[model samples]
Target chain A: MTACVIMGSGNIGTDLMYKVLRSYTLDLRALVGIDPDSEGLHRAADMGVDTSASGVKWVIDNADSINLVFEATSAGIHRSHAPEYERLGITAIDLTPARIGPSVVPGVNLKDHLEAPNVNLITCGGQATTPIVAAICRAASVPYAEIISTVASNSAGPGTRANIDEFTETTSACLEEVGGAGIGKAIMILNPADPPIMMRNTVYCGLADGYDPERVVESIVQTVDNVRTYVPGYQLKRAPVFENGPFATPGGVVQTRVVVLLEVSGAADFLPAYAGNLDIMTAAAVRVGEALGAARTGGRT
Target chain B: MTAAFRLTDSTLRDGSHAIRHQFTVDQVRAVVRGLDRAGVEVIEVAHGDGLGGSSFNYGFSRIDEMDLIRAAVDEADNARIAVLLLPGIGTKDDLVHAANIGASVARIATHSTEADISHQHMALAKDLGMETVGFLMLSHMVASGDLLDQAKRMESYGADAVYVVDSAGAMTIRDTMERISMLKHGLDCGVGLHAHNNLSLAVANSLAAIGEGIDQVDGCLIGLGAGAGNCPTEILVAACDKAGYETGIDLTELLDVATDVVRPLSPNQGVIDRDGLMLGYAGVYGSFLLHAKRAAEVYGVACDDILLELGRRGIVGGQEDMIIDVALELRQAADSSDAPR
Candidate 1:
C-alpha cells in the first residue's frame, strides 16, 4: 500500500484524512499542520494516524516511508513546499491553486498528468465545472465558457476565503487548459442561507452557430456519468437549457448558447452534506491518489 | 457644511440594463471621459448585472464587459475606475482581471440580509490593495436595525465603505435618513448611498443621506439606468452645491455631459412610469424590472403582479429565475379562476 500524508489540518485536510483512512490502496500516515490546537490534528491522532504540528517539515523528515503528500495548505505556502516534495521524490497532490504542476480534473484529464511528480486539483469550482465545460467542447467548438459556483457560506473555511483570488485565476485557466475552452470566466458565490444550501454550479457555454444541441447534450450526460463515478453526489440539478440564433456577446453573435445547472451533495463523510464544495475536492483527491497508488502497485489492487 | 464626500458615476454599469447591456466602446469612452472631466471621484463600468453577468439568463452584453471596463479605464485620467460585482454573478477572478486591467475599486454587492457572503471578495480586494465597497442591494426590503447589522458585517470583512443601494428606488426621505443615520453611527468605515429615481425622490433621498453625514453617494449621467434610472449626476451635484454641500464636482461639466453625450443615448427620458413606480411601491429590485416584464409577457401574467409578488416574497438579486417561476404560478392562478367549474 502507498503511504500518504495529509498536510494542513484544516477542514479540507481533516476531511481528506478521513477519506485517505478509508482508501483501499492508500495508507494514512500522518496529518500535519502549524496549529497544535487544530481540531484536525487531534482528530487524526484519535483515529490512529500520526499527527504533527510542525507543518511540512515533519512530512519531509519522514519522507522516507511516505509515497504521497496531500498539500491542503493555501496557494502561497504550497508554492514554497512544492519543490521540496519534488526533490524528495514524493508525489504531491496539491489541492491549492499554486499550480505547481499540470491541472488535473480526474473525470476529464487525470490520465494525461498521472506521470507528473506534482498535480494540482485546481479549486472546488474548477472540479465541479471544468468537466462539464470539457463535455460541451467535445461535442462542439466552444468559444467561451463561464461558470458560477455557489456554495453555502458556512462551508467555506478560512483557507477558501483567503484564496479567493487564486481560486478564480486558477479555475479560469484550468477551464481553458484542461476543459478545452477558448476563453473561460469563473465566478464564486458563498450563499449565506440558514440551513446552508448545497453546492450549485451554473455553466454557460457559447457555441458556434449551427452546432448540434442533441450531440452536445449527449456529451454532457456522458461526462456527468463519468464524474459520478468518483463524486456520487454530483448530478445535473436540471437538464441543459439551450438558446439558438444570434445571441449577442462582446465578441459578436454566437450560433448557440447552452446553460447547464449542476449540484453536488456531499457524502457527509466528515463535514455536512451541504458542504458539497469541500466534499467534491476531497473526493477527487482521493480518486486521484488511489489511481496513482494503483499504478505504483502494478495495478494489482 | 465642509464635510468631504465622494461621488460615483454608475452611467456605464447600472445604465447598461436600460440599453440591454449594449454599451459600445465609443459610448463608454464618451461617458467615462465626460464623468472624469467633471471631477467625478469614481466611475463604475461593467454589465448592468456586474462582471461575469453576461449570460443567456442575464441579458448577454453586446460587447464583453471587460472590453467596456478596459475602454472606461483607458479613457479616465483622474477618476478611479470602479466595478460593481454581485458576488454570485462575478467571481474573485473577475475582480483580479479588473484590477489588472486598471480598475482601482470594487463594489462587492449582495442582498441586504446576506452580508456574510461579501467576506471572501472584500478580504481579497483588501489583499490585492484595492479599495473595497460593500453594496447591500434591495436595501428597502429590510429594517434599519437589520441593515445596521448587515453593514457591520461588511465593515468587519475589510470593506472600506458600505453602500445602502436603493435597488428598486423604493426609499423615501425618511427611510434614507433612518438607515443612513444608523449606518453612519454603527459603521467604523464610511457610509454611502446608491439611489434609483423610480420614486422621483433620488435627489431628495440622497440629500437626506448627505444630511445624515453619508461620505459617498452614487448617480448616473442623465439618470440613464435601470427602472426609472439612477439619481441624475448633474442634478444631484447641482442640488448638493445649492445645499452648501461640497462635492468638488464641476456642475457645468456634468450638465454638459448629460446634454451632449448621455442624453442622446438614453432610450427613454428617466421618468417614473407605472411599471417603474410599482418597483418603488413594491420594494422590488430595480434590475428585475426588465426581467419581470419579459417573464410577464412569456407567462401571460400582469407585470405588476410579478413585481408585487416578488417583493412580498422578499426575493433578492441573484434569484432572477424566481421571477419566471412566480409569473408562471400567477398565470396558473388566473387560468384556474377563468376555467368553468
Candidate 2:
C-alpha cells in the first residue's frame, strides 16, 4: 500500500480523510493539524487513523513513512510546507489555491502533470468549470469565456473568506490555460439561505469560429460523465442555451455564444452535502492521489 | 455653513450604468471639468461595475476604463480621481495600474456580509499610497451588529474609511441611522454612506447618515445613476446648505453641472418609473433593473415580477447571471401554468 498523510485537520482535511479511507489504493498514514483540540483530529483518531497535532512539523519528522501528502491548509501555510514535501520526495496534492505547481483538473490534464513534485487542484470553481470549458473548446474555438460560481454562505468558512482573491485569480488562470480560452473571467458569490444552496456554476462562452451545436453539446455531456465517475453529484442543470448573433463581451463581440449552467451536490462525508464547493476539491485530490498511488505500487486499476 | 462631511461625486462611475457603460472621453472630460469647477473634492470614474468589470456577464464598457480614469485625472484641476473595484471582479494589478495613472483613491467594495474578501485589496490600496475605502454593498440586508462586524474587518485590513452602501435603495431612515452610528462608534476608520433614490429616500437616508456625523457621502449629478439613481449631488449640496450644515461646495456651480452637463444627456435621470419603483419595493439591486428588463423582454415575463422574485431569492450584486436564469425559469413556469392541467 502507498502510505499517505492528510495535512491540516480542518473541514477539508477531515472530509478528505473519509475519502482516503474509502480508497482502495492509498494507504492512510495520519491526519495532521495544528490544533490539538480540533474535532477533525478527534474523529480521525476514533476511526483508527493516526492523528498528529504538530502540523507540518509532524510531516517533516515522519517523512520517511509517508509516500504522499495532501496540503489542505491555507495557501500561505501550503506555500511554506510545499518545499519540505518536495525535499522529502513525497508527492504533494495541494487543495489550497497556492499555485506553486502547475494546476491539474483531473478530468482535463491530470495525466500530463502526474510526475510533478506538487500539483494544485485550483479553486472549487476551477475544478467544477474548467473541464466543461476544455471539453467545449476541443469541439470549437472559444475566444472568451466567463464563469460565475455561487456557493452557500454557510459553507464558506473564514479561510474561504480570506482567499477570495486567490479563488478568482486561480480559477480564471485555469480556464485560460487548461480550457483553451483566449480570455477568462471568474466571479464567485456566496449566498446566505436557510437550507444552503448547492454549488452552482454559470458559464458563458463566446465561440469565435469552427463550432457546431450538436458536437459541442455531445462533448460537454461526455466531459460531465467523465467527471461524475469521481464526483457522482456533478451534473448539468439542463441543455445548454445557444444564441446566434452579436454577443458583447469584454474581450470583443462574438456571433455565436453558449450559456451553460451546472450544479454540484457533495457526498456528505465531513461537511453538509450543500458544500459541494469544498467537496469537489477533496474529490479531485483523491482521484489524483489514487492515480499517483497506483503508479507507485505498480497496481492495476 | 461649515462643511461637515466630505462629498465624493460618482457621476462617472455609477452613472455609467445609466448610459450602459458607454461614457466617452469627451463626456468624462467635460463632466469632471464641471465637478472640479464646482469644488467637488473627489470624483470617481470607472465602469459601472468598477475596474475591469467589462465582461460577458456585465455588458462591456464602450471604452476601456483605464483610459477614462486617465481622462478624469487629467481634466480635474483640484479634485482627485477615485476608482472602484470589487475583489472578485477586479484584482490587485488593476489597483496598482490605476494608482500609476494618478488616481489617488480606491473604493474596494464587497457584499455586506463578505468584507473579509476585501481585506487584501484594501491592504493593497494602502500599500499603493492611495486612500482606501471599504465599501459594503447592500447594507440593508444585515442588521447593525452584523454590519459593524464587517466594517471592523475592513478597518483591521487598513481601510481608511468604510461606506455603508444601500445598493438596493431599500434602507429606511431608521435603518440608515442605526448602521451609520454603529460603524462610527465601532471602528477607528471614518464612516461614509452611498444611498440610492429608489425609495425616494436617498436624500432622507443621506440626511440621517449626516445627522449621525458621517465623515463622507456619495452623490451623482442630478441623480443620474442606475435604476432610480443615487442622491442627486445638486440636491444634496442644496440640502446641506439649508440644514445649517457645511458642504463647502458652490451649490450654484453644482446646479450648473446638473442642469447644463447631465440633464441634456439623461433626460429621465430622476424619473421613478414602474421598473425603478419595483427595485426599491422588492429590495432588488439597482443595477439589476437593466439586466432584468433585458431578460424579461427576451423571456416575455413582467419586469416587475422578475425583480420581485430576484429580491425574494435574496441575490446581491455579482450574481447578474442569475437574473437571466431566473427570468427564463419564470418564463418556463408561465408556460407550464398555461398548459393543460
Candidate 3:
C-alpha cells in the first residue's frame, strides 16, 4: 500500500486529511497535529488514523515508503520542513501559501513543477480562481492581466494573512502562464469586518491592443464553467462581464460585481483566446498531479 | 522651529486599496527606498495591522516582517522603520519580533471606540523598547470628548505619540485641526496625523494638523495608497520646509523618488479628487476604499453610489473596515440584474 502522511492538522489540514483518507489511491499513515485541542485529535483518532501532537518530530519519526506527505501547516512552517520530506524520498505536496516550493494550481502552472519532488498547492483561493484568470487572459488575448480577490474578513484565516505576498505572487504567476507572456498582477484582500461571504476573485485584463468585449465575456464564461467542473468550489459567481450598466440592487445587501474590459495598449502583440488559455492552465495542474501519481484525495472516481 | 517636520509613508500598506493586498517584495522595497530617499523619517513597510502568521492577501510586507524591515532599513539607512499592529490580531510576541527585526517604531492602531486594543499593544511595544504610537482610526465615529479620553489613556499607556487617524480618509481640515487641538490639550504626548485622501483632504487636513503644532505627519509617495491614499510625502515635506517647520526631510530627493520610483510602480495622474471627496462625504474610511473600489468594479455601479449605499447600510459608522464587502455586494447585484432577461 502506498502510504500518505498529512503534516500539520490545521483548517486545511483537517479537510485535506479526510480527503486523503477517503481516497482509494493511497493508504493513510498518520494524521500529525499540533493543536492542543482534544476535539480535533479525537476526530482524527476516530477516523482510525494515528495522530501525533509534535509538528516536525512526528514527520521525522514516521517516514517509510510514504508516497506523499501533504503539508497543510501554516505558511512558512513548511519551508524548512518540506525539503526534509523530499530528502527522505517522500514527495511533498504543500497546500500552504508559503513559497516553500513551486506553486501548482493543477490547471495553471502545473507543468512547471511536474518533475520536481515537491509542489505547493498554493492557496485555496488560487486553486479555485487562477484557471479563470488563465482563461480570461486567453480570451482577451491581452498583454497584461490583473486578478483581484476579495474575501470577507472573518472568513480569511491566518494562512491568508501571513503569506499575503506569496498568495498574490502565485496567483499572478499562474495567470502569466496562461497569458503566455508579459507581466501579471494579483491582489488579495480580507475583510475581517465584513459578514461571512464566499471568496471572490476578479480578473481585469489589459491588452497591448484592446479586443472585443463581447467575445472576451463569452470566452470567460465558457472557461469558468470548464474549471468549475474540475474544482468544486471554483464556481463563477460573476464571470467576466460588464457590471452596473442597468442591473444593481438597493444601497445595502450583498453586492458583488466583476468587470472585464478589453482595452488595447501600446501595440497588438499577444491576444488572449480565453478558452484555450484556461485549457492550458487546467490541464497543466492535473498533468502535474498525474505525473506524481496523485489520485483524487477528495474521493475521485 | 524653522525646521522641517517628520513624515511616514503608508503607500504600500495603504495602496492595498487599489489592487487588493497583492504587492511583491520588489515593489515594496522600491516603495521603501523611494520614501526613504524622498526623506520620509519613517517608512511603515507592512500592514497597519500586526503581521499575519498565515496566508493573507492584502497587508504589510509579504515576506517575514523581520526580513521586509531589515531589507528596507538597509536601503533606507536614514529613515526609521515602522510597522502598524492592530489589537486582537497582533500579539505582544509579534511586537517584540518587530523590534528585534530592526523596526524602530510600532503604531498601535484601533478604532476610536476600540481604544483599549491599541492601549494594550502600546504598553507592550513600549516594554519591548520600541517607540510606540497610538492611532485611533475612524475618529469621526467617536465624540471629541471620547477621543480626548482615548488619547489621554494612550499617553498614560506609554505611547510616545498619539495620532488621530482619519482611517476612513474622510476627515475635513476643520475636523482634523479640531481633533489635533483637542488631543494636544487632553494628552501629554506629542500629537500626530494620519490622513486618508478619500475626500481629497489628506494634504489639507495634514497641513492643518501641522499648523496646529502636530509633531508628525503620515503620507505616501504621490498618495499611492488605499482608496485615494494619504497625504503625499513629498508635498508634505516641501510644505513643511516652505512653512519653516522642521520636517527633517530632503524635499528635492523626495521629489526625485516620487518621479523616478513611485510613478513606475503604480502611476497616478494626480492627488485624490471627486470620488475620493464623495467617500469623505459618505463617511467611508480609507481602509474600506479599496473594497468600495472593488465593489464598484464588481457590480459595475458608480463608485459614488456604492460609497453612498455603504454609508446607508450602517457600514459607515463601525470600527470594522468592510469597503471590499460593500463592493462585492454591488458586483453581485449587478450580475443578478443582468441575468438572462
**Candidate 3 lDDT score at position A252:** 18
lDDT (C-alpha, whole model) for all candidates: 0.85, 0.89, 0.61
lDDT of 2 by residue, A1-301 (tens): 7789999988899999999999888888999999989999999889999998988889889889998999999899999998888899999999987889999998789888878889899999999999999998998888888899999888888887776778888889889999889889898888876677888898888988668889999999999999999999999876787866587765577887888888899999998899998789899999999887777666654
Better of 2 and 3 by TM-score: 2
Which ranges in model 1 have alpha carbons more than 4 Å from their true place?
A: A248-252, B1-6, B25-43, B49-60, B63-161, B168-175, B186-189, B197-201, B234-285, B291-341
Fnat value of model 3: 0.00
B1-341 per-residue lDDT for model 1 (tens digits): 44468899999999898887988999899888888888898999998988888865578888878888899888989999999887656777788999999999989998887787678888888988999999998888789999999999999999999999999898999999999999999989999999999899999999999888889999998888988889998999889889989988898889888899888887576767888999898888788888888878766889999999987765557656556557767877898999999
Lowest lDDT block of 10, candidate 3 chain A: A262-271
Query: Judged by TM-score, which candidate is best?
Result: 2
Model 3: per-residue lDDT, tens digit, B120-207? 5676787778888888877876677889997887888898898888877767777888889998887778888888777777778887
Taking all chains together, each candidate's TM-score versus the true structure is 0.83, 0.96, 0.57
TM-score of chain A of each: 0.96, 0.97, 0.73
Interface RMSD values for the candidates, listed in order?
A: 4.0, 1.5, 11.3
Instruction: State model 2's lDDT.
Output: 0.89
* Highest lDDT model number: 2
Q: Clash pairs of candidate 1?
A: A209-A255, A250-B63, A250-B64
* CAPRI accuracy category, model 3: incorrect
Off by over 4 Å in 2: A60-64, A248-250, A299-301
